[model samples]
Target: MNRYQVATAELASSQKSGAGVPAYLRWVNRGLGRRAAAVAYVAGLSPNAVTLISGMLSVGGMVVLVFLPMSALSAVAAMVLFLAGYALDSADGQLARLTNRGSIAGEWLDHVVDSLRLPLVHLAIALCLWRAGLPDWSVVVALLFLVLSSSWFFAQTLAGKLSAKAADDGSAAEGTPDWVSFAKIPYDVGTLYVVVAALAYPPLFLVLYTGLFVVTAAVAAASLRRKYRALLAEQRDYAPEN
Candidate 1:
């Protein structure tokens, strides 16, 4: 609602100091907001506004692609809209910092909106491939990417938790996120390549989608094994002596 109210709401979920939002995201947010920089000054739009609008754009883009498969031009436009949506998604934290009003609702909603984008985009891809007479395997691979990517994120989170506990017990040093918030590496690279392939040549995207899925699956599996071992180790330390 207001500045003080927003800050109070955010106190529940605010990131710890030094866990600031990543710079690449900040850079994207700043660059894209410049699209409406003068207007933001005049209208006083905040980060959540930018984020929600971008989410809408991403959804709209997928809807359009689903129905307008005949034109490569339209597909290109949809992908571009989705990209803009992601850019605005990046803008939210910076917008909060600049405005000094951040809310947990805003932070949570940013992720909720983002979570919807990938599934919808995949649906659009499945529709496109059906038209091309591709095998169902393509859709399966796409789903694998989403599922494995999610598992990888969760596995990494567990690893961090374990590391922190070990540090607390004096078994190790305080753990940091592996690298500047996981580099958004899989997402930044996967989305760009997928979008490019979708617009220029749909088959190219299918190939990239499958390739990325394979790589991500391997990474997720390895990470899961590490997390499982960590959990076992933690449990062993707590086992009672007979």
Candidate 2:
């Protein structure tokens, strides 16, 4: 294979099968990520370099939203930057795999970018809405939404830890629901689209936001329960005689 094909194939090998992506958006993101990875690989860019650019663009987009006055044109620009950042986020992992230089540090840094970007986007939007002179209650809603969404990430971390313990004990915890992951796309990879759509129609966006929040909140609770239950089961397996 040529370099481009080689790079794309490497990405395919390393990539998950749309783990958290909605069905409709999966193909688009996959194509964008692979293409970007190919281009970055051909350009001899390191994975960390791609990651740094992604972080800068994503964070800078939020900075625009929170610090500047809201406007349709500005919102569109922010969405473009955020989407580019996300596409590059995908490319970084693929590039890492292609270079055989994937490391724990790179993984942690990628996640750190995501961890910050997710909550900050919500906070930025909340502040933007406040600056737009929306009610104080709307800002409160935004903050609450941010808290619930960030909690979901913490729940996933807990689940990962419990899964590791369960695996060590040879107890297979139940498989995670695909739809739960799909439902979270609006809050993650799909955030730019969500924000753009919301910016176009504020009242409708509130309803949709509430719906997403409810679904994700439910999924987080379910995930946490499963993880905690598995942890208890592991304890029981190792428990001493009464």
Clash counts for the predictions, in order: 0, 0
TM-score computed on alpha carbons, candidate 1: 0.66
Which parts of model 1 have CA positions greater than 4 angstroms off?
1-42, 150-190, 193-199, 227-242
In model 2, the worst 10-residue window by lDDT is 166-175
Query: How much does candidate 2 score in TM-score?
Result: 0.81
lDDT of 1 by residue, 138-219 (tens): 8676665666555555555556656654223221123535375345444443354335436557576766777656666675
lDDT of 1 at 45: 84
Work out the TM-score per prediction. Answer: 0.66, 0.81
Please provide, for model 2 over 21-69, each residue's C-alpha lDDT reduced to its tens digit, 9 standing for 90 to 100.
5543465666787889899989988888898898898888888777766
lDDT of each: 0.59, 0.71
Question: How close to the true structure is residue 112 of candidate 2, measured as C-alpha lDDT?
Answer: 83
lDDT of 2: 0.71
Candidate 1 clash pair list: none
